[model samples]
Target: MSDHTPSPDQAPGAPHPRETVQLIGQDAAQQAFLTAYNSDRLHHGWLLTGPRGVGKATLAWRIAQFLLATPPSDDTGLFGAPPPPGTLDIDLDHPITHRIHAGAEPGLAAITRSVNDQGRLRNEIVVDDIRKLGRFFGLSSADGGRRVVIVDSADEMNVSAANALLKMLEEPPARTTLLLISHQPSRLLPTIRSRCRTLRLAPLDPDDMQAALAQTNTEVFGQTDHLAALAAGSVGNAVRLINLGGLELYAELIAILGTLPRLDRQRALKLAETAAQRGAAEKFDLLLSLIDIALSRLALTGATGAAPMPEAALNEAETLTRLSGSPRQARHWAEVAALITARTRHGQAVNLDPASLVLDTVFKIQEIAGHSR
Candidate 1:
C-alpha cells in the first residue's frame, strides 16, 4: 500500500489520532484503564467503546504508548519495586514516542481498512488483514518486549476477519496488548465483545471540546456553543463542520425556514444553486443533513415545548416555533421530513440534478408549512 493513501480512520482535514499526543475530556475512561494497570489485572484485549470522534482511537494510542514506554513492575530487589502508574502521559520526546510518531515503532501495529490487490481501499477488513498480524506477532515476539496492536474499528471487520481476531483473543501472545476501538459495540460479535474488557468514553463538554480543538490548532472564536451543539461534542464532526462552512449553511437553512408558509422563492433558489455547484457534493450532503436536523428539532420543540438548546443556527428557534408550534404541526413536519428525505436520497442515488433535488425538498417543506398555517 502506498504510504500516502488516505487513511480510512482519520477524518479529512483532521490530524491522525496517533498524532494527537493527549486525549482530552476522557479522564474517567483513562482512570478505568489506570485502575486496571495499577492492580496488575490489565486484560490482554481492551475494547474502547464510544461515539465516533470521541477519542476512542486516541485513548488506544495513549494506552499503547504507556504500555511500551513504562517498564513492567520493575524489580530492583534491594531498591524495591517502583510505584504504580497514575497516568497514561509519557514524555512527548521519549524515544518510544518519537518512534510512534514516525510510524517506526517496531512493537506497534495499526490496522485499518487495507488496500486490496487493485490498490483500492477495501470497505471491510478482510481475513488477510487479520492474518498479517500473525507475521507481526512472529517478528515482534523475538524482542520479548511489550507489543501493542490497535484495530481502529473492529466493527468494520468482516466475519472471517473477526473470527481470525477472535482466535488471537482466545489465546493472546505473551506481553501483547490488543486495543479495539469501536464506535458501536452492538455491531460486533457477542463473543468478541465478551472476550475484552470495555473502556467507555463519553462526549466532551463545550470547554473540553474547545481545549481539544485548540490542541489541534483549530480555533473557534465566538461560536463554541453553536459548534458544540451542532457537533454533539465530536471533535471530528466539529472539524468537518468548520472545514465546510457548515455553520453558515445551517444558518441560511434556518433563514429559509423563517420565510415559511409564504416561502421566498428567490432565497430558496440561491441556496439550491449553491448546493449544485461543482465540488459541492459534500456540502450538498451536509445540507440534506441540516434539513433533517431542522425537522427533528421542530418535532422535538412541539413535543417538549422548547427548541433544543444552544441553537445550531441563528433564528432556528424562532423558525421552529413558528413552523411547529403544536404537536399536530410537528407531526406533519416529521412525516414530511421522512418522505422528502427518502425521495431526495433516491433522486440523488439516480443522479438527479443537485439543484432540482434540493429545490424540490424546499418546496415540499413549504407545502407542509402552508398547511400548518
Candidate 2:
C-alpha cells in the first residue's frame, strides 16, 4: 500500500497505530501475548479485541515487529536460545522497525477496508480483501520467516470475507500469524472466534490517556480529566475531541444546559449555527454525540443521585443535577433522549436543515425539563 493511501484503520486526527512506539495502559494485554510467546503457545490466529482507541492495533503491530525481528526460540544462536524474551519492546533501531515504518515490511500486512473499482473506499472488507492475503502468505512463505497479517478490524469483514479467513485460521500456513482486531467480536463468525486466542485491550484511564496523548502530535489544551471523562477512556476519542475543539464546545454545552427549562436562546442558536456552518460536518456529528453523552449523564445522575465525577465539562455536574433531580426526572430524561435520538436519525436520513434539527432537539430537551419540574 502506498504511504499516502488512506486507511480506515487510522483514527481521525491521530497518528497511525503502527507509528506509535508505546501501547499505553494495556500492560495486561501485553503480558498475555508475551506469556504465550515465551511458553511457545503462541496461537497462529490471535484476536486483538477491545473498544476503539484502546491500543488493539498497536498491540498487534507490536507483536508483528517482535515476531519478525526475534529469532525462534528453538533457533539457538551462539548464546544458546536467550532465556525466553520477557517483553515485546523491540528496539527502535531494529531493521524490522525501519522496514515496517517505511511500509515495506514483507513479513507484515495491515489489511483495512479496501478501495472499490470506482476508487471509493468500501465500508466492509470483501472476500477479495481476505483472499489478497493468499498472495501475502505465498510470497512471504519463501523466506521461511514469520509472516503476520492484521485485519483491522475483523468485525467489518463481510460474510464471504469472514468465511475465507476462517479457512486460514483452520489450517494456517507454517510460520505465519493472523492478527484480527475487533471492536465487537460478537459480530464475527463463531467458528472464526473459536479458532483464535483473544487478547483483550482495555480503555486507558486518565493518567495513561495523558501519556498516550503525548505520543501523538495533538496539542494538549484544557483539562485532560474532562477529556478523559468525555472520551470514555478511548485515546482515539480524546484525540478527536482535542482536534475538533470538542472540549470547548462541550463546555459551552454545559453552560447552556445550566439554564435548563429556559435555555439561553442566543447561546443555543450560536451552537446550532456552528454545527450548521458549511464544512462543519464533522463538528456537527460531534455535537450530536456530545448531546447524547449529556443526556446519558443526566439520566445517570438522577438515577444514582450523584453527578459523574471529574465532569466532562465545567458546571456539567450542576446542570445534570439540577435537571435530573429525581428518579421520575431521570426516567423522563431517558424517554426524551430516546425520542430525540430517533428525531436525530430521521433528520439525518432526510437531510433536514442542520440548524432546525438542532434547535428542535434542544427545544424538546427544554420541554422535558419543563415537564420534569
Candidate 3:
C-alpha cells in the first residue's frame, strides 16, 4: 500500500479520501449505483452532492474501482452466469486497487486544484487543468477497460474550467465515467447539474459517525459525543476540530460569551493576543471561525425558541438563552454575525492587525447584546 497520509495542514492521522476503502453512512448511494449498474442503465456522469467530508470522494473511488475491476456483464439472456454485483467492493489485492493507490492507473484521471509556481495549491481549478482531460481521453484504455475521471469538488472550478468540463459531459466517450463531487450543488451550472445523475449523501447519525470514526482509527475515545455535536456529522470536520484544539478554544469562547452585555475585557484581550502571536495564523483563523459559529447558534436559538444543545461547554445553552431569547434579539445577532463575517474577511484580505480585528468583533457583539436587553 502506498503512503496515504494527509499533509501537515490536514487532519492528523486521517487518510486521504481515496485511501478510505469502506464508506460509512452512504448505503443508499451505494445501492443506487448498484441498481443502475446491474440494470445496465448506469449513466456516464454522477454528481455526488452533500456537506463537506461525508465520503463523496470515497464513494467515487469505490465506483471507479468496481468499474475498472469488474468486467461488463455478458448478455447471455438467462443462463449465462451469476447475478450482477450487489456491492462495489473489489479484491484488496486487485491490480486496479494497487494502481489507484499509487495513482498510476492509466484508465483514471483526477482533476483538482494544482500547485502554482509558489508551490501552494491554487485557489481554483483553472481551465488549463480541465484541458488536460482531452489528452487523457485521447489515449485508449490500457486494457480495453473503462476510463474514469474524478473531480474531487466541482464547486472549486472557475467559470472557464466549469465550461470546459461541461463540454465533456455534453458528449462523453464510450465506457467512460465522470464523478463530480460538490459540497454545494446549487453553485454549479444548471446545465451541468441537469446532465448528471445526482447522489446526495446526508450527515451521518451519531451511531454511524462513531462507526465511521472507528473505521478511520480515530482515537476520540471519550469525546465522541462532543466531537459529533461540534462536527455536525462531518468526519473531516471532526478530525479538524480535534487537531486544532477547537473544542477547548470553543469552551473558552463560550466562557467569555457567558459574560455578555458586560463582556470580559481581560479574557477577551488575552484571547486576541494569543491569536495575534507570530506563526499562529491557523489559530487566529480558527478563532474567527469559532466566533462565527457561536453567533450563528445564538441567532438560531433565538429564532427557533429552542435552546442550543450544549456542544462547546456546559454553560453554552444557558448563555445562548440569556443573550438571545427573543426573535428581535435573534435578528439583531444575525445581523451582527453578517457584519462581523464580512468585516473579518475584508480585514484578512487587507492584512489588518489580527488582534485588532478580533477585539473589534467581540466589541461589536457586546454592543449588540447590550442594546438587545
Candidate 4:
C-alpha cells in the first residue's frame, strides 16, 4: 500500500483510516480504544505515545477505521465498536468500507506535515492548519454521529501551532474526538499532556523485530543476535539498517575492530573523515552499533583467549562498559560514546547540521584511538 494513501475502508473527513493495523503485544491499549468505541465513551482527545517506529500512527489509523464504520451522534462523532472477532468479521467488500479506504469519510480528519513550495518539510503543523481543523470539526457530522480529527503527531507542532492546538484542547467541541500521535510526550506541553487520556505503546521485542526483519527479506550483515542487541527495540531502525547497506557497513566495522591495534593514525583519520562526511545521525548510529558489537566480541575473547585484546579494543571496551577497575583507555572510549549520543540527541532537537556532527565525532574517535596507543 502507498504510505500516504488511506486504507481501503477509510474516507476523507473521517477520523479513522480504513487500514487494519496489526497490534503487537498491545492488547490492553487496543482494548481501551475498542472499549471506548463500544460504549460511545470515547474521549475528545487521545495521546498515543511510544518510541519512534513502534506503530503509533498505525494504531491511530485503526481507531480511525472504527470511527468511520459508524454514523456520528448529534454533537459527538462516536461509534459503537464492532462485535468480538468471532461474532462478526467486518466485511471488506462493503461500499462504506471502500469509501473509508479512499479517505472520503465526512466524519474524519487528519493533520500532518506536508512539503511546502520550497520542497522542505514545513517543520511544524501550523496555526492555519489548526484553525482549519477547528472549522472542520465545528461543522455538524455529515453521517450524524461522531467527528474525529487526528494529528498524526503533536510533537512536530511549533510553539504557535501548539498554542493554537491548546485552545481546542481547552474547550473541545462536543461529539468530536481528537487523536494526537506522539513519539515524545515530554516534548509536548504538560497542559496538553494532562488534558488527554494517554495510551503508551511499548517497544517491540527481539522476536518481533526478527519477524519484522524476515518479512522485509533483506540481508542482515551481522548475526541476528548482534543486530538485535544494537537495534535496541526499534524495528524501524532495524529495517533501515538492513536496507541501507548496513551489512556492508557492519562487515567494514568488524574488519576495523580486528585491526584497530595495528591501525595507524593516518588511517584512522581517513576513516574518521569518511564517517564525518556521511550524515551525522546515520554515521553516529552506525558507529554506536559497531562499538557495541566490538565490545561484545572483546568480552567473548577475554572469556576464552589466553591474552586479552592486546590493550587495543579491550581497554576501550572495558572503560566503556563502566565496570569497576576499568582501564583509563576504556574510560576514554566510553566518554567518546557518551559524546556521540549526547550530540545526536541535541542535533535532533535544534536542527544542527548532521555532516558537521559526524566530522566532530570522527576527529574525537581518532584522538581517543591514538591515546590508547
Candidate 5:
C-alpha cells in the first residue's frame, strides 16, 4: 500500500474513501478464478484465508470489481453465484469501480471493523454487519445480474456475528457472491469454513514486496531490503514502518542491543522510564520490535563471530525482549494494549499510570527471562 494516501480530489467520493492498497502474490488466486471460468465452475461463497495484513480484502474488492461491471449473459451457465473468474476483466477506472471503492455498490456489500460511538474502533465484526449481508445479497442484482457481499475478515466475527453469517450461507441468495476473508481460519468455526470455498493466500515474496515499495514511492527508507524484511511480506507493514518512523525506532533498538552490556542500571531504568511515558500500545509495539531486533542481532553475532559484546548484558536484554514478545505474556500485553487504545479512543483518556504499567511489564519480562535461563 502506498504511504501516500490519495487526496480527496484524487480519491473518489472525496474524504474518507477507502484507499487502494497494493495487493501482492494473488496470481494463483486470480488463476483459480480463471480456471473456474474456463471450466464453467463457480462457487457461491469463498473464504479467503491468510495471515494478517495479507491482501484478503484487496482480493475481495478485485472480485467485486469484476462482478459489478461484467455482463450478465457472461455467466458460464454455472448454477452458483460466481460464474467464471476469467469472465470479468476488472477495470479500476470503471464507473462502478468508484461505487465499489466507495463502498456504495448496491450489488456489493462489505463487512469490516467500524468505529464505535464511543470513538473506540470495534475489533470484532458485529452481528449487525453480518445480518446486512443477507439483505445485500438477497435482493436481485441491481441490473438483474450477480450480487456480492464481502466480509473483510470473518475471523473477527464473534459467535453471534458468525451465526448471523451462517444463516445466510445455509440459504444463499441466487446470483449472489459471498467473499469472506479470514486471517486466522483455524479460529473460525468449522461449520463456517465448510460452507465456503477456501482460498489460501501466502505471504508476499521478497520480489513482490520490492515492487510494491517502488510503487509507493517511499524514498524515506533507502534500505528497501531492510524494510521489506522488516515488513515480513506485508506491504501494509512496510508502509506503516516508513510512515510511523519505525525505521528510526528499530535502529535505536539495535543501538540499545549493541550497548546493553555496558549500560549501567541508571541508564536502563531511564530508558524504561521513557518507554513508560509512551503509554501501553506504543510500549508494546516497541517491546516487540526490540525483541525482533535483538533476535536479528543475535543471528548476526552468531554468523560474524564478532568479539563477544557484554554476554551477560546482551543476555539480560534478550530475556526482557523475549518475555515481552512471548505468547503467554502477549495475552497480558494485549489486555493493556487494548485498554490503552480504548482509552485513547475515548477522548485521549489517559487514566492508567504509564510508569506502573511499564514497571509491571518489565518485571514480567524479568520473570520470563529467569525461567528461560
Candidate 6:
C-alpha cells in the first residue's frame, strides 16, 4: 500500500503555498486586486486578512508573481496600448515563476518564522527576519524591476518585528509591494493596518473546498461531507481532520454521547484509553477539540430552537435534541463547555494523565445530562 501520510508541516505532500501555482475559492479578492492594478491605483502594501487556510497566502504569492513578471506601462508612445493584466496569472515557464518557486528571485523576499541555531523553528518572526527585508529593499532590483515582499503571516511577528515593518510601510520604496498575510488582522499594529489596503478572503464553499482538496490529492473518498462540516469551510483544517481520523473519532464520540445520562462506560473507557496511549498526543488533542465542537452544536441547537443538522456525525441532531432540548439545558451545557475547556487546557498544561482528562470531561457531560433530567 502507498504511504498516504502528510508531512509534519504540510498536508498531503502538497507544495508550500508559495510554490502553489493555482489560487482557489477567492475570486472576489482576486478581482478587487486586478481592478486596482488595472486602474493604476495599486497600493504599495496589501493586507490579506481572513480565516486560516483560506487561500490568503496563495493569493499573496499570485500577486507577487504578477507584479514581478509584468512591467509597468509607459504611456510615452502613440502606439503605447499595453494590455492591462486581467488575472493574477503568469505562465509556469515565466522566468519570475521559475525564480520564485526556487526561492532565487532577487526581486522577491518572503519573511516567515526561521529556525534557531538549535534547528527548531522559533515561535515568532523576529526583528532580524524583518531586517532581511531592509537588505532586500536596499538593493536595487535587477533591471529596475518591481520588488515584492511577502510576510506569510503578520500575526506571527513579534512586536519589534511589527514596528520594523511599520517603518517600511511608512516610507515604502518606489515600485515595491508588501503583501502581509494575517489570519487575525486585529492583532496587528493599527498603524501598519492603516497603511495597507485590505483584501479579505472568505472561507471556501463546499464545491471550492472539494476542488482544493482534490488539487492537493487529498483522498477523503466517502467522508467528504463529514470532513467539510468538521472543518467549517477551511481546507487546512479539513486536511488535519482527515489525517487524524477525525471523522471516525467524531462518530464514536457522538455514539457515546447518544448513551448519555445512562452513560456507556465500556465504550467511553475504550476511547479514553485509546487517547491516553503513548504517542497518541495528536489524537488526544483532536478528541478534546471534537468534544468542544459537539458541545457548541448542542448548545446552539437548544438555544435557537432550529432543526439540528447532523453535519459531523450520524444521529448527532437527535442526540443534541435529547441532551439539550431547552434554553436552560443549553445554558447548562454552555457552562459545562466553558468549565471543561478551561480544565482541559489546564490538564494539558500540567501534563496530567490524558485518560483521566478524557474521562473527566465525559463524566461532566453525563452529570449535566443527569441534572437536566
lDDT to native, each model: 0.89, 0.89, 0.85, 0.60, 0.59, 0.85
lDDT of 6: 0.85
For candidate 4, what is the TM-score? 0.70
- Which digits, one per residue and each the tens of the lDDT, describe model 5 over residues 176-275? 7788888788988888899998877877887887765565665543666556556677665666667655665555444443443343345445545655
Model 6: per-residue Cα lDDT over 148-194, one tens digit each:
99997899999999999999999998889999999899999999999
Candidate 5, 20: how far from true, in Å? 3.0
Top of the candidates by TM-score:
2
Error of 1 at 116 (Å): 3.1
Q: State which candidate, 2 or 6, has the greater TM-score.
A: 2
Report each candidate's C-alpha RMSD, comma-separated, in the order given.
Answer: 2.3, 1.9, 2.8, 7.3, 7.9, 3.4
> What 10-residue stretch in candidate 2 is worst by lDDT?
1-10
Candidate 2, clashing residue pairs? none
The CA lDDT at 271 in model 1 is 94
Candidate 1 lDDT over residue span 1-373, tens digit each: 7876778888778788889978999999999999989888989999999888889999999999999999888544667787887899999999999999999999999988999888988989889999999999999999889999999899999999999999999999999999999999999999999999999999999989988888877767677778988888899888888988888888888999898788899999999998899989988988888888888888888877788898888878887887787888778878887998899889889999989999999998888888887
Model 3: lowest-lDDT 10 consecutive positions: 1-10
> For candidate 1, what is the lDDT?
0.89
Per model, how many backbone clashes are there?
0, 0, 0, 33, 0, 0
C-alpha TM-score for every candidate: 0.91, 0.94, 0.93, 0.70, 0.70, 0.91
